[model samples]
Target: MRLVPIQSVKEGSILAKTIYDSEGRVLLKEGTELKDITISKIEYLNIYTIYINDKYSDAVIEDVIKPEIRQKAIKKVRDVFYNLEDYNKNQNNYQGQNLYKKSEKDFQSVQYVARELIEEILSRKNVMIGLVDLKSFDDYTYQHSVNVAVIALIIGMKMNFHKYELFDLCIGALLHDIGKVFLPNEILNKPGELTEEERKIVQEHPKNGYDYLKGSYDVSVPARIVALQHHERIGGQGYPEGREGERISILAKIVAVADVYDAMTSTRVYRKALSPNEALEYIMANGGTKFDYKVVQAFSKVVIPYPQGTMIRLSNGDIAVVTKVYSQMPLRPDVKIVYSEIGTEINSIMELAKENSIVINGLEYEVPEDN
Candidate 1:
């Protein structure tokens, strides 16, 4: 399967991955044929790209979590956000133990999902993640929460966090943006630049989320602070608390890097998603300044620059696809050469770490299928 822009997708092509709607419901299941009407429906939902089956690109794209697990995580996130939205909409007269019970239930369910994700990652012995899971723009926050949790878990695992610590980190990272539930859809999904006032309101989400979690939920202090201080920078230039250095807990610091990486790599309404290399470059550039250097190191260790099944161009002008990424040498992953410089078909696997001169130049999105 190959990820292609919506416009480039042909009508008769088949979908290689499942597509979810704004509410995390399955909109188009995998293996669904992309007819004219189906393609139009996808376009109407503001989904800019999708994975489609290609005869030439034999590489397979795998998500970090199982399909059921990812969907369940997304569903839980959606439920929590929706509950918060409902509470905000009805806080005036709605009073009972029910609210507290629901909040407790939500937090508990979230904890279960986090623990499940941790188990899955732990079972895979040093799992490396890919740049997948781009849902609709309207569902950005919900999907992003799950993705951030996964990324944060990978980083935590790299740092040798035990199961208990991973639980707090995972739960905190998942609900880091819960405060955004109070935001108006117009402001949250605004296509244009946010004004000064709007930006101020946007910056208040961390504090708001922290307050709600602290006051109503049964989460740990570390988890609560993650919502409050995940934006905190290493040099005291972050929002809500302006915390610096060790003032921020290690869990929050870890989530800080994870949050930025996911946000920058995601496709937002205002800008396009950055490539993996581009996002990593930004993170590495800001390491120890805008981000914690130690956490950034952990991030570099787990996130593969080119995940398995990603088509890339080598320095020698050959087109290749990534097979595996080494934790020690993430930049130089194992790749299978699929085409020669002159567009001739070739199939050879090369370990990039051993090949001194073969460098990965950039991502290759458009490879021939009927060449």
Candidate 2:
């Protein structure tokens, strides 16, 4: 299967992966032929890219969690956040009232999903982190929460967190953005720069989310703190509070990196998504400043910048597709040069580690200006 931009998708192509909405509803299933209507519907939904069948491409992308389990996790996140949103519509938490009321079942449901994700991920010690999930503009929050949790769990495992600590981190990372549900939809979905006043309101989401989760009887304090401090940077520049390095807890620091990585890689209304390599570079660049150094280091060791099936450009001016990924050497994945510089078909696969001279120069989804 080959991933392609929605604009380049042809009507007769077969979907290579199932597309799910925020509520775990399947929009389109794998192997289903994309007709004019389905293509149009996908575009209308604001989905930027998708995976489709390509006879010449042998690249395969794998998810750490099963599709059924991942979908349920997304649904669980939806349930927890939506229920809180519904409850908030009636109560006034601004007056120091506890937000969650009889929320034990809801909290436990999220914990169950988190436990499932942690177990599934830990079982696959070699699972490479790939930014391949399909999500729409409207599905951003629910799906993004799940993806962030997955990424955070992987990074935590790489750093060798204790079993109990991993559970707290997983739940904390999953509900990190639970505050956004209380914010106005207009501001949350705005496609342009925010005014200073608007920015202040947007900044309240972390504390707002913290307050909401703090009142929960089942939610752990460490998990609730993740919602509060995920926005806090190590260099004292982040919002809500200007906390410095070591002052932040290790759990929140880890979730902070995970939160930004997925948010940067996931396409949003305001900006196009950064390529996986590009996002990794950004985290690496700001490791000591905006993010915790240890967390960023763990992120690099765990994630696959170029996963299988990625179309990339080589230094020799040839267009190639990623055929294999080396977890320890993320920048040097084995690639098959499918076409020469002038678009001539070559179909030659080479291990980048052995070919010391040929380097990856570009990504297919790379933004024009970014290139």
Candidate 3:
């Protein structure tokens, strides 16, 4: 099954996944038959196009692809949450170092998933994909982990790292947050400002994660180091160890930059999500202090600061929606001129970077408007 935009959704098509709200309530369920009114109702389902059956191409709207992805993501989050919660309640419940061992084993599995995704993207294969919806904490966690791993892998590939090293980097990134399992759910899901003590606990997760992984047999040294050192700052202001520039491992520094960018741009309980461009701007400004400069530069090159489907305001008082991400100049993507300054439909696609006089001043919509 492939994705089709909601505007292109037809009456006989079936939904591939259950659409949910920020509160975890289901807005629409999978297998629901589409209607024009159904398409017009929901607001945040932008980016995704509907899927149709490949077999008949007409007899059925078999939504096999996205639904499976949604189910997998949901299951992954639920399983991790429960397992972590269980471990959190009993720190010494393990007879030996099983907690860390279990985490390592889990990492081994998820690392494979990360590698497969990277290979699929790199090969330009026609793989099924459902967009990462950032409407929930679980989505933020799972998707950010995957995104960081992909970004790091891409950078590693470009830097000419061997296959073994790239695989290790994938392992390092996927397990970077495995220590968050040790923190209390209240702190992990805290919606308000965290106290100094709470902030310290949050910061200690890296070392805690590393220690746990190190205790387990068969875990690579780089995996443990990455878990511990991903928070180290280049300018010596980061947490846990606060190691200076060269002291921090190169892999850790790379993951550190990718982690911060993905987290800041993703939606969380505390604040509304920053646009991808805004997150990149924040990263670029703090590169020398909070992150490695070269890593940040690499990320800027690979990640689309203005990903497709975002709405932007132009200097000419026109409003447009992003339609495609170009290989060059990620900050300036191709946009569809959806509305004029007065909110009239233009139905035209405009290449912003190629346009001679137009300039995008800002993004106005944090949440996408439903079709």
**Which model scores highest in TM-score?**
2
lDDT of 1 by residue, 216-257 (tens): 657889899999999889799999878889999899999988
- If both were scored by lDDT, which would come out higher, candidate 1 or candidate 3? 1
**Per-residue lDDT of model 3, residues 167-265, tens digit only:** 778778877887787787799889999999999999989988787777766457986788899888988888788899889988888888778776776
CA deviation > 4 Å runs, candidate 3:
1-84, 91-107, 125-135, 342-345, 348-351, 354-357, 364-371
RMSD of 3: 6.8
Candidate 3 local distance difference test against the native: 0.64
Question: Which of the predicted structures, 2 or 3, would earn the higher TM-score when compared with the native?
Answer: 2
Residue 265 lDDT, candidate 2, scale 0-100 = 83
Model 2 residue 137 distance off true place after TM-score fit, in angstroms: 0.9
What are the per-residue Cα lDDT tens digits for candidate 2 across 1-371?
Answer: 77777887887888998987766778888989999888988999889889988654655677779998999998888888777777768665445544454567888999999999999998996666886577778778888888888888888888888989999999998899988988998999999999999899999999998988877778899999899999999999987887889888888999888888888888899998878888889999999999999899999998887878888888987777888888889899888766675444477778899989988875763312212
User: What value of lDDT does candidate 1 attain over all alpha carbons?
Assistant: 0.84
